[model samples]
Target: MKKTEEKIIRFIDAHKLIEKGERVLVAFSGGPDSVFALHFLKKFQKKYKIELAAVHFNHQLRGKEAETDEKFAKEFCGKLEVEFFSAKLNVKKLANSKKLSIEEAARKLRYQNLEKLCKQNSFSKIATAHNLSDNTETVLMNLLSGTSAAGLSGIPVVRGNIIRPVLCVTKQEILEYLEKNRIAFRIDSSNLSDDFKRNFLRNRILPLLRGKINPALDEAVYRTTSNLKSQLTVNERVVNHFINEFTRKKANGFEIRLNIAEVFGEIPGELLKVLIEKNFDYEFKHEDYAKINSLAKNHKGKKVNLGSGITVIREKELLCFQKEESSLTGEVEFPAGKKAKLCGVTVFIQKAEIEANPAKKKAYELISADELDEKFLLRTWKHGDIFKPLGFKGTKKVSDFLTDAKIPASEKKNRLVLLNRNKIIWVVGLRISDEVKITNKTKRVYKLWTI
Candidate 1:
């Protein structure tokens, strides 16, 4: 047996990535790394008593070049007598539609397709060709991007049903093995272009760093990431406890109610970032987390707008993720006596002649028409905005009012405030201002209902 083959088998055994009688699907991109991986897995198929198959995804970015790669993958698999599956996807279109980067769209689609094939074909494991250099690049990317501890761990050898047997190997080693065996592999031209972030790191930055700084950069990164991953496994247990105790499920997403007194000094920032990612799918930077941690010590009602349309708001006793309509805009305005759709709620505003007094309701709010002297502005609640509830003694800040009402901080941002002539008249869906209350002297009423 070859040294490379022995190393791969040992790595697989160490990770327990595959078992006897299991069917493995290879993500064959026709690239050098994947080609070597496919060959290595094929060599061990009989030794491990496992079934092998190959899958190719052509992200339609390079037109004819992508098709040629797909063709190469199919032909290569056919020559090896392995079952092959191929797919062509409009990755550019998917990226534009989802507002994701081309790289992110391609990766997500590729894994999604691979998972689908695994289930359809009853494959037990999906193997990818991520190598030691890829791990180093990923760690550098995470460090440069201000990611949490888990992000610095790089990619895992086994993530769910996906496995990477070549993670312990280097790209140079794979290339050498392929050359030694005289195995032909297609080269992706895009990898040489520095236009993409990963390519920039792979072809330029990483090589320069390795040559100038440390010759064994990949090995150092692999060891560091491995250590970090071990630390993360221990930290995850504590973080999972916090998540379970403090979080509650909502119709939109998860709500985390972290009590300032109990949570301020107890939780680590990295763990908090992981919790947010696990719950909200947002990759928060260190600065983003700095602002979040600051909220724990700062005065209540402080909020920060994180990227990816996620907002974190603070309250007296809780810190929660604010939920809003996915389609809601920054500044929203609604005309009087008209129906409009805003924030997934269809709100109708029409003048009505109510008999002297009407029953109090939860679904609608009826206010004196004279109160709406100016055009209605429907927008998110801003700090320092005050409203006087119909029966309350004095005006109160919207934030304070919501907190006092025991409203989850996450729902506070979704509470729209209707302002007239720059005065808050209604904390819509909650309370009508004292100035807008209906009385015996009220002649007309403006009714608001959500349908």
Candidate 2:
């Protein structure tokens, strides 16, 4: 075997990533790394008795460049008697629709295609040419974006069905191999563009670090990340403990009390978010943690607004967290001589005489500057959580109201009901009681909210 081929075999053999006679789908982007990877893997295929194929995803960003890459990859595979498959994806459209970055969209699309292709073709393993430089860039990018220890630990060399046989090699070594072997490959122009966060790191920050610090900065950082990953092994145990203690199941899915702000002090806030998302597939933004942390020092009963209609209730001893079932904005209305709560606003309404402003922050609704309420019903809609829908004298299942509202299944359990003396005044963001809507005979207005 050639030196490069021997190195590739040794790396994979050390990891035991590929079995003898296994079929492999190699992710070939037609770049130097992937092209050299394809060349070397083909060299070793006969000895291992492994069948090799190339899979390419055209992200449609570089227009003809993707097509050029695909054609080149196909021809290269064809010349070597290897199977080739290619797909085109609308990466930009996917990114825009999902509100994700272009890099994220392209990555997600590429992986999905790889996964689908492997499933269809019965390939047991997928190989990529991510190298040590890639690992360093990944760790740096994650750190700049406030990643946890897990993120700093760098990319895994082997992840399940995916294997990076070229991970031990550096980008410079791959280039050297391509030059020495007289190999042809296409360059992705997007890598030169600074618009992407990763490109910025790769082009600007990485070079500065290399020039200013150690010349072998990539290896240094990779080692640092490995040590950090090993060091944080103990933190995972404590994280699991907090994850279990704070989470609970309600009627719907679950809620996390998140009172462990004191228990896991040194851990980055991102880990807390990870724990929540890992357990419940739910989370708040980074700044939301700052808000929650501030509340930890304040008095109890302080409420916080979490997005997607969720609310964190900071209690004296524990935080009682739940979802708000209504729109964060918009209005609720009530009429003459009746009591109600604007279901969406979570505020109560009563008919009274003309006087004050109607819009107030907490637990109050629109009446007229004229028709105001003296008393009203206040609660969230519950499953057996009943609500008397407006214009109807009878109460319906709060679950039914949610169904009619088309509330997402994940959020169904969180809708709160506002009841006045056991009568449904409002369903909170859905419908208010008909008896309390503004009428021609309304008289007053009353308002409330703390400045």
Candidate 3:
């Protein structure tokens, strides 16, 4: 076995990238790197006890060259008797539609196609041809563009179902192996031109750095990134502990208690940044972290819009990181003996006799059946809405009632109210109006509850 192959096998074994009898799909672009990966996997298919297949994606950017690459990839797979799948994507159109760079759009389409193929064929692992050279380039790009430690950690060896088995080898090793084995692979013309950022780095910047500074830059980067990833794994455990302890998942987004800062006083902003990233998948800029920390110390009701539909509001002693909710409109009619779903909660009304005193019960509210019409309107509580509490004589604003109940300001909009003839009869899961309370004179009663 060659040294490159042995290294890849060792990496795969260490990472548990593939299991026995697992179906592995290789992303074959007919380029040197991907072709070598497919060849290497095929060489050890029986030894690994795995089924192998290949997929080729045509980005449609190279016109005739793209079609040729697809054809070559199909023929290569045919020659090896491996299952082949191919897809042609209008990457330019996708880039324009999504307002993303051409490279980003291509990558998005490529992964989408690969995942789709995996689901259709029940593949357990999708292997991409990301080598040590790719990782080094990524780390350098992230460093140049200003990134977090996670970005500097480079590409993950195993992300969910995707694996990079050849990550242990470098581009030089792949080229040398291909040459020694008399393998033919197609070259992407786009890669030769220095039009893309990656190509510019590969052709212009990396060579100068390697010649002038470190000749072994790739290995050095690989070692550094490996260490960073290990440290990140440990940090992730701590972040997850904090998140599970202090954060609550709501319908729209996440609610993080402000007490987390006191719990983790050592650079709590970093923890909050990671927590927000985990929930919203948005990377916060350096200034955003300061803004978040500032908001944490600011007065309640203060908020910072973090773009991308994400807003962090300070509600009393809690920090609510939530997506902007659309205007709450529309109401549903709740009929007797039937349930109505309004604003994520199911409101049900059924005719029944009051089994226990309403004051002693917390699960459901008992309302006077004679006061309600044939149906009731269930809708979100709006401003200026007033309802009389069961124990109070005068009417109170629903907003004030919710505030008195200690509900977070961010959650008040989702609170539902049941109305009879435009009069508030019950605040769902909270309290019923004094007018609807069952009394000794009431003959029939209705039970209302929410799940």
Candidate 4:
């Protein structure tokens, strides 16, 4: 074997990228890197005792050029006698409709297709030909785009069932091997056009760097990135211990009770990013760590809202975080002659006399005080807190009302529940109670709500 092939084989063997009697799915784009991957797997199939298959996604952006690539891949697979699958996608239309960039939309669709094939065909591995150069580009992109340590760590060699056997190689090395072996592959015309960010890196920036600076910059960066990935893995394992100890669980969300920085103290920025992403799925602001680090040590009851619908509450020396999707506070409004629900709270407006004003205002709905219940109480949501809604004899819990009505978290606390002593009379913004319906005895019509 040639030196490059030996290096790739050794890397794969070291990581167990391929296993004996295993089924592997190849991400075959018919590009040089992917083609090299195909050849490498072919060379190792007998020795590894593995079954390899190819899946090609035609993004349909390059028109005939894309079609030619797909045809080439199919024919090449046939010549190799490998099982091949292909899909046609309208990536441009989907991206435009979703308001996503062309690259993102295509990537999502491609992965979805590949996963479908893998699951259905019983393939345990999906291999992509992402080489070292790609990782450097990604790291640079993340840095330029305000990336954290995880971003700086660059692309992962293996994530779940997805494996990159050629991650240690580069575009130049793959091209050299393909040339020496007389391998043929189709070019993606769009790649040559600088319409995408990756393309900008590959075509414009890489050449400039190689010409002006170090020719081996990609390898140098790759070496640094490989080390970072190892450290990140360890940090992630450690952070999960904190997550298990301190995070609170909810039916619809979670709350974190401990400040992250206090315990770990100076965790690598990359590890911090990973922990935050695991909880919130987003990177922090530039000053997030500094602020968090300070607050963890000095203050109590400070609040921070990390995205992914998660909120952090600092109170009583406990830093609590919860997903924003669920709310503990609820609302209720009792309309005169009506029932309104504020999440788990219920209210009824009955016989209240609210007078009409000369100003003729529009926002508030008023009713007579007589329509309201004599007493009302707002409390936590409980199971089987049932009430008979208007137009129905059947009763249901206040718990069911908020969920059924789809009340938003922000509005839950703000909703008012009108009540008659212990019984709920109305749920604001929803139904009024039959018991609270205004009669002609009501001399005044009460305004029940206001904007």
**Maximum-lDDT candidate:** 3
Candidate 2: where are CA atoms >4 Å away? Answer: 1-4, 249-253, 265-273, 276-451
lDDT of 3 by residue, 317-337 (tens): 788888776776669985789
Instruction: Tell me, by TM-score, which candidate is best.
Output: 3
Q: What ordering of candidates by lDDT runs from best to worst?
A: 3, 1, 4, 2
Candidate 1, poorest ten consecutive residues by summed lDDT:
322-331
Q: CA shift at 415, candidate 3, in angstroms? A: 1.5
* lDDT, model 3: 0.86
TM-score of each: 0.73, 0.67, 0.82, 0.66
Q: 313-429 in candidate 4: lDDT tens per residue?
A: 555445444556545565443333555544444444344334434344443334334544434554444555566666667777765676577654423344554555566655655
- lDDT string for model 1 (180-213, tens) is 8899999999888999888888888988998999
Off by over 4 Å in 3: 1-3, 6-22, 46-49, 60-65, 88-109, 176-182, 189-196, 249-253, 263-291, 303-311, 322-329, 351-361, 368-372, 388-396, 435-445
Error of 2 at 236 (Å): 2.7
Count of clashes, each model: 0, 27, 0, 54
Worst 10 residues of 4 by lDDT: 349-358
| Better-scoring candidate (TM-score), 1 or 4 | 1
Candidate 2: clashing residue pairs, number: 27
